[model samples]
Target: MTNAHDHRADLTASFEPMRHFMILQSESDVRVLIRRLLLSCLLIALIAQLVQSQDSEINEIQVGDYVRFELRGNTYQGPVIQATTNGRLLIVDVSVDDRKSRRQVKREACVRLTPAEMNSVFKPVPPASKSEPIELTMPTLAEPGEGEEIALTNEQLPSVDVSSPTVLDWSGFQAGKRRINKVPFDADPDLPYVLDISTGTVVYSVASDHSTDIFVSTDRPSDYRLVRIKNHTVRIADTLPQHGVALGLIRDETDHDKGLCVITGLSTGQPRVASAWSLPKQKVRPLYCHYRRLLPDGSVVCVYENTLRVFDGRDGRLCWHCPVPAFFEPAVSQGGRWLAIAANGRLFVVEASTGRCAGSIPNLGKETMQPCFSPDGKMLAVYGENRMVITRINDGRVVLDHQANVDLAPFGGESLWTAPAVLVTPGGYLMDLRKNMLVWKYQLPADVNEWMGAPESGWIPIINDDWLSFVRIPHQDVTQLSAAVDQNALVAIQAGDSLRIEVEIKDDVRGDVDAFKANLTKALESSGYRQDISAEALLKAEVVRAAERTDHYINFGTGKTESITYRPFGARVTVVHRGEELWSANQAGNLNYHIAGGLQRAAKQLEQPPANLFQTMQLPRRFLSKKFQNGLGKSSVSIDGVK
Candidate 1:
């Protein structure tokens, strides 16, 4: 063999011996080394695993757990009850806050109070259970990071149910004439006071003896005062301003314009122009570059002619500003972001702060006037000669274009004080944006000189174009009631513990679902309700079993797809078939069905009642009962031939 071939074979042979040695190690040196390496690795792995396990321990209190936290160096314990958006927690302890005696301390920090940290005054204590009582011991306050566990146990509390009593209408109260002054006031649900701007004083219609002023505002620095005017003398009553005076026009409970009521003075050289103030704080400041629009965060949009501005109401500050075309009269939405204005004959919607053209409604030749925003600020109603346009603010889509003789000239720099024409033209329209319906028309009334000359204490136009008018739109409540309509024809109505649920099955299966859904929807609604849906009334109606039905029966738990078969009756139809068949066969069902039938006959409760009878009553349950009885009379089908 050649030397190269010999060397190759020898190298291969050497590698074979090394491979064999690696595969099978002898006990003395190699085996000992392998065992030592594996043992070291396993030990390291075990330590790592144990470390992870210890680190995974949860120390924070979970939801629904009773826990406590240290507040003002005192440890208070209660069920980690409920949390509010403001970070206040509701505990089980109930006590009244002693504003007079309690040493008050204000903290600027926003810290979530644990159930234990919250005051006990507002907590609802549950009634004590008669069952076995468990003892829960809580540890005293400990320093942060100190490893200590606090234990809390559920305990019996007082059983008290609080509710709002039926309110007596103010119309029923005796009327007495008293002169009052107008002053700056905030809109309060409790102490609602209306101000007449001309007098610069407040009118407190509600007597202090009749009702206590419960509302308090933190925005104003000084305590609010309740001033009374009697016999030409003004005196401050026992009431004091809970907060300082934040001057601005507030939305009134009634007898006020719905549009933004900003009282601005000649501050920025604009004649009869005043700066808009924030709602709660009422701090006066120039609009972000003097612009007017509402921001998305519920702040007002400020514009000064060409300059755009956005201000934060919580604290008066310019959030953002820019410049854009100044041709149109400015309007901002509630959010203060989207702004709509009419330039020349067309409409333009733009970003309030950036001054960028978001959208536009074009192709009009006449100069537009009197642009009114829908409640949501999503649409604008533009008035013109011979035609009125409703334009979408965001996309520039013309939602509605109604042609009519709407005078648009009166609002174009026509002085409300000088021209009677200003009263009839170019003012504004009241619109319900949610329903996309026009509710009222407003403009400065015509015959200004004649009407102003008329002898009167105040030139109160019983109806004026310049003044806003609110008219009810037909069936507006249907929009809200449609939301609560039962998918299955059944709804539960309850009174105390008594419940009546009526389910209806439509004879016309194809049209039944839709027709019944619609009829039930209308039945649930009533006229004069501001909003469409009343969740409380709907829930109450469900409990009383007085729910009107357009279909066969009120459904319980049965779904459309679910099938329940009666034992004796083998046929499978809707779930109602099973209930009917089962009742026909069972003795208990037969007895109950007959009893109900006899009651219906004895009382003649099913007799049809006049529609006008339902005007005074809210639910019209009696009317519904009569209608249901008429329906039942037409059909002979019953659970056990009880009819």
Candidate 2:
């Protein structure tokens, strides 16, 4: 180990992948970046003492520094890989054969490598091919554990027999954009609140430059009145973006003064009390955001950075606090008993009162978005780009899993005493979850581009620049649809055609079925494929590997040898049309996350095949194929095969 002054200039050659390095204090208060070219920053923290494998300390080391750490009475040294954001976690690749094969340990378990150990190493894993089989013993993959990273619902709920629900044809629902009320845009108009929900009526401050306005859920929103209250002449800055309406407005009828629940504080300010305020009082504040919901007890739970805090609704006093990594905004249950948050690309449930982490959901993809709790707080719906999920809270069981559709919004769920009869299906469905089917459905009006439900009022609101309109919908017209994967793709067919494309997941070698689906869909869409088709054509495409078998094997010579030799671990792509297959092919090696990376490689090959393989396949570098061309040379066919 050497001082920072003696750091080698050639270190960047071996650690270019790690962009750069930053030296942050133990607490990571602030970072001092030391650039290693234009590389990714590796946060380095010099810990005081070394501990077990789970946690350790490291030297004032740089890239290419061989470091050792003690765990369970044994010491293991490996070249330093890289440090994470806060320098609290260090990712070390123990096996040279597998770049993805690494482990995360604390900074305390790290020490510098000896000169002798650094010089003594074996050969790296070589690429594998059918021409030369490297026969060697390898450990079989372990069975997936009881703990799956992403375990959403595996099957649909028991089919419920729901009655036909009243349907509002998009046409019958006259839609227009109109401003309900016009005022000099209230306080801080530029920083609009993320959402505003009304059971029907809402309370707004009038433009007396000193008064407020109101419209109760039972009254029309256009009707406005003024009320007197204190005002604050302060310009506070915003801290968080507004999102997640699951945690609706915090309203208190108790104060009678039409009290609106909120949290105050901008950048430097801390969220003190959580309640409504006039000029002297404040409504929900940006310092505490992502999502905020009111409890029956007049308390409000708000997300402020990495912590979830409950503020007393009456006076906005802080109550219990739950600590979780700051992530996409957090949502509180309508009942206020459970809290839903996303961190590290997974959904985590928290016990609001105890701040105890209940369970973390895995494999909903590597990135998760706004997660909403059902009104009853028993089931939850999580959103993602490629997949959408609804799971139960008690065991974190998935209630529904489907291809992700940004249009579908998770609004509300059935209450304990009520029938499961309401849901918001953006595809124009008045579905009955109890019946597990659509009672009535309609399509969006051609004129309306996007539709968003009002926080509470049965009104579906729309706005175009200066205009806004409240499209009224009857409560009976609202129906809750059962959670299911919306794997709907626009089929290209004629008036008399039908279509079906089989979804085959050969081992999900990539581990992520959603990502695979997304990739395939993207390739298909980009290839001009997802257009409407007729009922007579059979369009079947199989998503399988190129080789259909393992091209990788590993060998560990003996306990005396520290190296493991294996070939490249990669992914292959094969798109089959009907039982008839199209002759076209593949190529993984020197990698980990075999399936994920393989999928990427396969997709790339599909888009732009290697020149040599392109010669053998005989297809002019095309990603997808269309069946049954019309008189105009257009793909017009009916598909029904390979489900």
Candidate 3:
């Protein structure tokens, strides 16, 4: 646990959360705790702020009661009044202290307090009620200790009509804000991120303490802390400089290759680079150490502009240097056995072991771009503006020369080579470099917003506004392409008096059952679900499995070994309509399915059903675009060509 790299192994011990409430420092502290409590209760939501109180007395807030509540960030007090329409929850005609008139507020955000917090100096103005308004009563319950966690029982939950408008609101809440953000920090999502590939932890540069800091988040992004600061532009290599050591190349703003580099331990954050060499005068442009490859004999190859420099993997020492004429990025074989260089219009094949040219493919085109090696390293795929050509690396032979859509871009938005010889373009087939055949392809419908293949691998990551989806490649036919493959289908019904969540975790599995239940309850309630002890139906969820997989990688530049723990779980929720089986859906398992997030999603899905054609059009593309974008490339990976 002392080693930062090894600390990842005992994640449960390292999972310490930040304090919820901020300590307020006031000059004249009369009610510092009171001010902090009021300020810290505020939370942000996309559509509307659903004000939730830590007080248990919220359950006792009834119709005709005058209560003070927070809305957005402001506080309001008013009488609970019926909604303007039928089948809607009670709304409040709140009289804000500053406002001369009244403002209507949803009763969901109302807060209730125990008798201990009641002030004898205050008096109830009026209560909204039916035939007769009841008198307000105070001093009902005793004061609770600060920071006390109030656990709600089934008896404390209030029941409301299932058809209430609160549950039927059309506001589509952005759910991703509540989930783990997978995008890179301090860089565009589509850009090739600076990663410690050994550990796959993306590096970030954030301004802190009047300096640019370099660090990686422990688990989630919010859990990030200060690691080290870099006053200048820094470059981190793909592999370790030493066991649990991270090596970063640093240079001044002049873009000189003569600047020195440093090796920092991942565990201790101590400088491991003992000697600072006065570098030789060479390439002037700032070098970004990319395409790092570790060879068989503890040697490493890294590419920067037109230069491929091999260095000792164990220690920072130059081994060999190869020149890449014309400076187009060359494609190397997976294990660094062969390298494909596209110089001018011809593609030259070179032996990586001896840096000797073997063969050449003459006259690819006047404009050839994005040359990539196949998975087996036997073939190379070159992407052009409208054509993709796959050639064998051993001998100069064109395996497949196919016309691509003007919109096809491989790596990102442009028609780039997805893998060695494999290319995916919009409205075209997914060409496989290995077999010189189309594995699968699709033509997106007119209404479809955006699309693209993620990488050379067969899977594609799709994001539509706040929604995210993934699908496997090689859909050769229409049935396979357009088939309804709903991995995130949630069917929430007007469920029972209570949600009975049964968690069945394996003996070795570790999770927080209480936290899981509470989160699920919150999700269900947000989705228009009301607890009714008298209801005949019950929504029963059984977590059939709770499993986790831990992966170990090089402990960044710190000697501390780091590991990633993935919680892959599955559960099933059944709607029991008067003891008859109504419907059931099984939760799929993946890295995305955290117990709390799954429940929140299911609840949200139930609250917001599948949008019809007309409904989806009105939905906001806040993630992809704020307003209507007439641009051709709207999605992350534009098959129609990345911009």
Candidate 4:
């Protein structure tokens, strides 16, 4: 029995070792499974954190933050007024060129403005530094080009008495000299003058009150005297040195006797205040610069070298000085509330009282003239090299940037500005500021040789060989005439006349033909004409030349290039009646930056029928002239019979 038990014990020992090995392997498998599960969880958490960080970066923008964004190929910067819950769309308040507008943009496209940019828009202009030198990119003075002088024989000159100075009754003179005698005087035509239509007063510089000075003597010149003509009487206003030249004159609208005169020394060519004249009382004030204007509140604003200074009229104390890059004529708002000046190649508006910059815009053009404020001071108009820019004063937004057909440069005449209307000098084209379109063209009488117009008052001083007469603009009659002409044109078109045009663009012109067709059709309809495919009239346009040009400019210290592409074309429109050519006209397209724009210009030109067509329709007698007839068919009417 002992032997059998020993064998069993030995077998039991071997089995025990195998059982322990199995238990150890099972424990190892469990630990390996737990480690794999933990690793998977850690990987998922890491991915979630990365996604959350990306989302926060994208939606970081908030309300009331100033941001700049790109939309439709244009970049705009403004404060965010509202934001969508999803943070996708945002509403922005944009002010460009002194005009304000609201626009909606995608949040993804916007970037927050830097601290430096914010300061530029909202901060007050820094005080002028006397140590800094003036930086000038262009000429300071934009003098008008000299016109050819026409030599007049002594026979052509008017023979007038120099000792007598006369002025007719203001009311009678305004009423076409019905009961007033024609006043004659000898004054230097080249001298600048200020005419107050409200007070019927004229202020001009003269060599002497008794001298009929036709020409200003260069050597041994007599002292110039400021003269005032009112109530059929001429009186010496003030006398200045022979070297003193009047730069500008401003008469107090509230008090005619109170006036401010800017004078420059001929020898030094430095501008300074001659005096603030209170009729017989003259107070010499200290101020300098030819580009100076008198504010309505008796403050004087002057721009010199690289600084703009405002002086208190009562004490002649410097109110404030702003640092500017260059000098240009500063414009004052009607009530002296705002001031606009060109500096650093940009136009800036400042609070006349505090010198705080409201807003600024670059690319104001090379030669900006004195900006004119609207009657209500809400709109500002700037003219430069025939280009006009009208901006709203409250917010800096450009309402209009137009290349005007008329000359906008001041030609020894004042630019007439009434609310929403501007009458350009020389051309006499009245433009609507809000509408951004030409309203009308005024025609002067044949007898008038030289004229000055005050469109706001609807009266113009017409200078003739014999007398200077005033004529009131017939606004009511002009309105009626315009309406009648429009009616006649519409009637002529609706009668299935030859005005029905079909536009056909040549295939050789490499451009968007479909766009051209659509633009041409719309233009024809606006011009009181019909477009029909089956019409007997055909307007054909062909591209003469297509070219691209590049202009390099330094903008805000950055070099930039502008790609200018233009398509020059010509159009011939012909109308046939009963298989015979009834009317035909040929026109060359104006220079346009786009092919579609070129076609549109050509369409507008072709819309005007031949002058003979107006005669056939029995239009007004004035319409028979080619000049007047051309005006009637276009958007802007020519009243002065420009050829």
TM-score of each: 0.27, 0.36, 0.35, 0.36
| Residue range with the least summed lDDT across 10 consecutive positions in model 2 | 629-638
lDDT by residue for model 4 (303-339), tens? 5544666654433345677555343455555445676
> Tens digits of per-residue lDDT for model 3 on 14-37?
111111111113233659656644
Compared to the true structure, candidate 3 yields what TM-score?
Answer: 0.35
Which lDDT tens digits does candidate 2 get at residues 576-618? 4344232222343323322233333543444322222211211
**Candidate 1 residue lDDT tens string, 425-532:** 233222233322223343333422112111101121221211111111111232343334332332222122121213233321112233333333443344122212
Candidate 2's TM-score reads 0.36
1 versus 2: better TM-score goes to: 2
Every candidate's lDDT: 0.27, 0.33, 0.36, 0.37
Residue 397, model 3: Cα distance from true site in angstroms? 2.4
